[model samples]
Target: MVDNQSREMAATDPSAELVRLINGYQISQALHVAATLGVADHLKDGSQPSDTLARACSAHPASLYRLLRALAAVGVFHEAEGRRFSLTPLGTCLTGDALGSRLDYARWVGTPGMWQSWGNLLHGIRTGEGAAGFTCAVEAWTYRDQHPEERAVFDAAMTALSRAEARAVTEAYDFGHFGCTVDVGGGEGHLLKAILLACPDARGILFDQPQVAVTAEGVFASAGLTQRCQVAAGNFFQAVPGAGDAYIMKAVLHDWDEGDATEILRSCRRVMPATATLLAIERVVGPPNQDPSGKSFDLNMLVQYGALERTAQEFQVLLNSSGFDLVGVIPTYSPLSIIVGRPAPAA
Candidate 1:
């Protein structure tokens, strides 16, 4: 299917893709702003005059209208009368009493450093590097270290993403068989806490970097899970504590490439008991458009990190290299699927 004419137009038309891509950032940024401002939450009943919203939010009326208008133009929200806007279907995804409300995640994405790193999409494609090191024009991890506020956003965003899935995963899996469970690279201990709450017999440990571990204290106490949950702080690159009868890592493996991902898995393998289970719950991509979120997130991984959301077969290969065998892939209520594997028995 060589379309000579279409190819020629695409080659010659410089503005076609770039225009949308550039403006697409604006759309995302606008959604972030609107979500942060609780614009959709206010419009849950119906549209109101722009001035009223501006006064409520302590923002300028004209500027507020401009932001709403721009968001409405993108179909995130809808406008009926002049300067009056409300939630669209897409906007509603950011609202309601849903577990994974986009509010926290939306705000997190617009946070300065996270937003700035995404601008390096071109760097990921051109250089094929994480572009993580360049954030400071000097040392790597500098941006994350220097900006604890942005890191808080990142933590909240991860928690926001895992919210609905955490509950879903907890219910979908039968943890009645396990004694202790460790969540490796578990951001803020949200998912593990969800699992432990669901299966009270299961004791949980949260393993993450020191900074993120600080957040677990609050989440644990708030959930009244302080008695059941243990928080451990360290890098998974070196080792993972082998304290659990089963290990679960949701949405963590996809953030790294094969080498690094394999390393983390191997570290888990080192810690996991011979009889323990390893679960990698991730967006298992299939044929194009068969699943929207998985496919879309595949590109997100490429553009943001130097990794990928992978297929089940791909997950198997990485797990195999790390001293585990693919056991099964379990589909849950969410877009993510669980890829289960377990290590060879110890002598």
Candidate 2:
């Protein structure tokens, strides 16, 4: 809810505030354009004249300057004397190689396919289906495969988000006790890499599609964990190879509807030993009338995958149906919660 003080400020100029809200997409579009032009990366050397920056980014000088002017008003850049602009702290985050960079993420979500898909939000609400009718994760992946550049952008965005969440998850969970851990649908193996780094004694398995596994292998070699971890490529809906003391799937199940989620869980369950444990890491939905990131994520799931972020009880039911008992939910510094489960005892 908007606080009363904030409401009062908006109330004083309701039309202006309402119009700003209505036109919020313009800011997003500006950010997308800036990121796509590599503006932050170009400014990394130092401030430059708008004409020079335009030449570097291969844009019309006058138009580039205008975009920077708008962005600077929003604190993304610093407009100096004589049409020179420099990267602000916020603008630096758009640098491709910057730590925690969101450049690719901005570009990815702003791509025409995604932009138009989100525009079809009403269709999803009315039909309970993606406007494009994506019925499974594979369809989306296949679409990405056909667009190599967009796929690369999407992959980089996932990598950035994984890096952002990895430290919080590793710090919150004690992986030291598990002899082995398997990261199902682990993209680029970042989470598993963090786990292995934290628990030096633990060997790990990173599983995903073959194309994704190639990248994960590189990540493992770069981390000097090639010997300690193995990369296995396959669909989770079919099977997840390599048994381990623990299995973890982060932000995976939320990409699926209940039937598909259960099938994926059952695939994991078949491989789980009686003593083995499972963890589903996701942002759990909160109560009614409360705004949480999960609520926004749920809408994203609806528009993208026809899925929903689950509550604790919803997760418990999913686990129970898959032959596991939900034990506890562990809090992380991130929005993600680790829903812990173990195989049920003989009936």
Candidate 3:
């Protein structure tokens, strides 16, 4: 009784596919563990026995061996012999050592902290309230503000991500025209440093809160930008440093509701000279049925911050309400597009 349905079912078994899907979570956890343990650094050039690797990382041999085997199967490492594994090119990069590594970002995103908040996404959808309750009953910034250990992890991941994004923003934008610039909410000043390196004549300001300014000093000193760039520890919601020709905010406005986003913009508007321009770098959500990054990020804002990504039309409305109008939008080399607006000339 070899029916066609029976034959097809036998040829394409479902168990393996289901198992692969079910175990995808383990891949994320394993990579997180690998990054935490510095396995990629150890395995960079060659292979090592599981027992030896465990000793180096100070973990149990059997537990470490299991993780290594799991990671190896997924192409992060190569199981060459009985218990020795070598780092594949993919594996070494998972250590957050690459030019544009998302390794630490992945770790932070998949950690229990963010994972549990995302677990409450349904609540966000139903109530229109964000997942602050699930995320330590605090906003993302507030969570980092309270927990020092978590803050360090978050800061490290953010710095890495910012550095990677900086290259694209620097190369894509024309900074030559601007004599001076300021990066608002520019944690660690990497973005400002990159912009300074790109625009030789441009001196700069890195205006962020007091806690953030401490981190900026280290970055500025490292980049030798302390002489050219002024790191001002202040609140952007209160005011922005009014000296720069151009004021920039990256991935900042989308975290706020439209009203708050406008307030922030208006603050910049208030501090600016009539000729000063504003550059807000954000993901411009395209039309519906377009599967762009902003679409998913919009929902992320919905769950995480009670915010949403804006279409260009939406941005125009906000800009006009804030006493500025969208002069034009520039597409940059990064995922972020530059929304260039200016204060009213005279009217």
Candidate 4:
């Protein structure tokens, strides 16, 4: 779609694009500040002058005005007469209570620790491990547990992602065949709840760590699924509860490296009935030089968890080694792709 002149311009002046890329952090930080200060929420009713927002958010007026000016330049907000700022579509998404809001997500990603961890991305790449101790020895959850407020924000951000992606997954796969679908390591049971809603006749089991199971139980109860769904607590690396026509693990395996990931899968294999299916809902990395969401997320897994998003062939190999047969991948409406597997035949 590019015209020859546009192509020539890019070919001649790469500095402009490079500078834009370098300044990307400015935008991220701006959005983080907006989300933390609830700037979008403050302007929800209508446009307001920077002074009003500064007073409402308890921030310095001049500093807040400068921030808003920067954001408005980036199209996050629109500056109008009287120096009033109105939320643009992108800015509205920062409001805490907006549908599928990413406020907590912004705050969590922009946390000081997270920022420092990302700064060591070069070390992660050089050593093939997380330089900031974000890998298995000092997991991200360890940091979360130490910071309760940040943990809450992390949970909220996860819930937001689930709210956005769950329905797409529900539409992508048929749950009717399984009488009891167990969401292994499912936090708060959002995806399972969505599946149960879509397939009214199917039942669900929310399996997770004890703390997560407690929340899952409450979520199922609130969804009026108490009778149809149960909460089972266990350590996935050691064992998973032995029950279900199908087991679903979404965004779980990418948190661990191959050894740990295999161990977790083997635990499921040990408890899985021969007739059961294992559905791994994850982002499958594509070819090189392409800008796929999974590719960028792969880098995130690398620096944050020392994990890698696998190609379909890599997944096939992993599943084959973990006592499962690789069945094809089914792409969902979202970025995630479902890697279907079943128990391998007896040796």
Candidate 5:
């Protein structure tokens, strides 16, 4: 009762929002702990006593009860009369077996590597270098490559995000006209699978690093696309597969700064046919004080990769410099937008 009164009082206070924002890490960490313990999965059946949940999760009963009640106060779970808890609508998204679930993403964000990098955000701002270099002694990609477990977690997180965004992207744009589509740096082929499923006639080429490309074979085979989709492995900075009617690089270019991003676009242009279209799926930063998600994502890029999300104008410049004309920017239901480009006319 006192807690509820305090909450109401805080809600009416002008500075309460700022205080909550400052303590946002508590919510994030709590969610991470719940996700890591598969709390939502266990709660999917029905409400259970906190002690039962703790026993199932191998957690301390008192500590787990405290965590669940806190999450309940935030609407992630529901607290009943005897310390029993049930999954709320928001909590359901954390279930590992659910389609488009954010389970892996929750796990990924709370990893020590990500925590350490974000913790050193001040260093990144001062030095104009990624915190990954300072914290892990390497760039983000190299750090993940060296840590196999972390790489797997990161890959799963990417795949989870792709699963959630795939339908939105496919619905926003048409790929049926293209005879062949190439997914550059497509991880685990979730987006590519969604595309092929939507456009039955369009064959696909899933391209990525050798180690990454191998994992997509199973994804394609399981999707019954092995005969129609070919998994190719190589470096995108050097070259991409040729003859694709449409080439897609989703969430790829944002990992690099201007120079390297331009080089990637150029590499795509070198192999792309005059008739082929280029699609860069990424978040476009919005005007000042708006689009908090995009702005925060830009900061994440800065901290982890020394990169920044581009605006529409910046995307146009990159495309033009890479011998392509910016065709259009297509928005989807998701945060990502498809920035379309086509080969420029000869001089």
Candidate 6:
């Protein structure tokens, strides 16, 4: 006879998994609410009665208890005696003070702009245009530019994301050889700071738009790299800093379609010494039925920016068009990969 566990597994309803997948948004929104209310931060010390948490969060006592109980059911928090709740290991990721905290990313996902764009994903699929442009009547970047509050949240989200990946990227690749590393479109300089920290002998140029690059000074200062790093403000489409031994564009090219991406690369090429190396740090889409995370990110890119995550072959083609020869793709512990390239031979 089959064992009890095997029988139970066999008896499970197939539709149950589909139902959970369909209701995934509920969990996302719940996590967003907790992050916004700083619930995880409050629970960092120890378990507290739901009413106490409610007061701390300025939320309705009974309602907060319900939310806590629900999150407990989902393994985000552990509900104890007397309706007290404590953060589970999974929940610690929502704490703002924690290393690799995803608080800002959760907040960004629940922001109005992101919700509106994803809600209109069908429109993008049907029209071959970004849902953000269709729904917001402006491109996503322009929308953020118009709303300072949203822009701040978006920037924090990007920095949080970069912080989570920076260590893995640095560990997977060696940057010690390059004397000067220029991070093209490096917002807030998280990755550059990490690289500088890892390679004590190397200096860096943090380059981005004026508004974005200006905020990186504090990041460098906090890392004690103020003297070694220079913040350069400019548009990557127009120009990038020159005289760097290595150039990095992390999570940058995926924000644009092929034409715009190639132009950005060409701008870096225009100034890069033939000896300098270029690294495009991004997700390399895997073959069919694999790399689900990358494939899902590709869909989000379509909805939000009318762009995509590329396959290895696509990256090679893109590099060739932009005056670079593909060297090799280096994998990191994280989902992102380092696509190494060099300037094509002079014709």
Per-prediction RMSD in angstroms? 5.5, 3.8, 4.1, 3.3, 1.6, 2.7
> Ranking by TM-score, best first?
5, 6, 4, 2, 3, 1
Per-structure clash totals for the candidates: 0, 0, 0, 0, 0, 0
TM-score of 3: 0.85
What is the per-residue lDDT of model 5 for residues 276-296, given as tens digits with 9 covering 90 to 100?
Answer: 999999999888789999999
Q: Clashing pairs in model 1?
A: none
TM-scores, one per candidate: 0.83, 0.90, 0.85, 0.93, 0.96, 0.94
Write one digit per residue (lDDT tens) for candidate 4, span 1-347. Answer: 98999878986787978887789888888888888899999999999999999999999999999999999988999999888999999888898888778888898788765766777889898889864474334666687788788788878888998987898888899989899998989989999999998889998888899999998888888989889998899889988877889999999988888888899899989989999999999998888877457787788787777788998999998999899999889998788889999999889
Candidate 3 residues 1-347, lDDT tens each?
Answer: 88999867765778856777777767877887888787877876678999999999998999999999988877998887779988777886776567666678666766665667777888888888777555568776677667777677777887887887788778778887988898888878888899998888889999888978888888888888788899888777788888779999988888888888888988888888888888888889988888456787788787677788889999899899898979888777667788989997657
Candidate 2 local lDDT, 58-130, one digit each (tens): 9999999999999998899999999999999999999988877889988987876667667878978998986
Q: Residue by residue across 107-164, what tens digits does model 1's lDDT show? A: 8778766676677767867877664544445322466568877766665666677788
Estimate the TM-score for candidate 1: 0.83
How accurate locally, in lDDT, is each candidate?
0.80, 0.88, 0.82, 0.87, 0.92, 0.93
Flag the better candidate by lDDT, 3 or 4.
4
lDDT of 2 at 105: 89
Q: By summed lDDT, which 10 consecutive residues of candidate 1 come out lowest?
A: 132-141
lDDT of 4 at 253: 89
Number of the candidate with higher lDDT, 3 or 6: 6
Model 5 Cα shift for residue 301 (angstroms): 0.9
What is the lDDT, from 0 to 100, of the residue 187 in candidate 4?
Answer: 89
1 or 3, greater by lDDT: 3
Worst 10 residues of 4 by lDDT: 131-140
Winning model by lDDT: 6
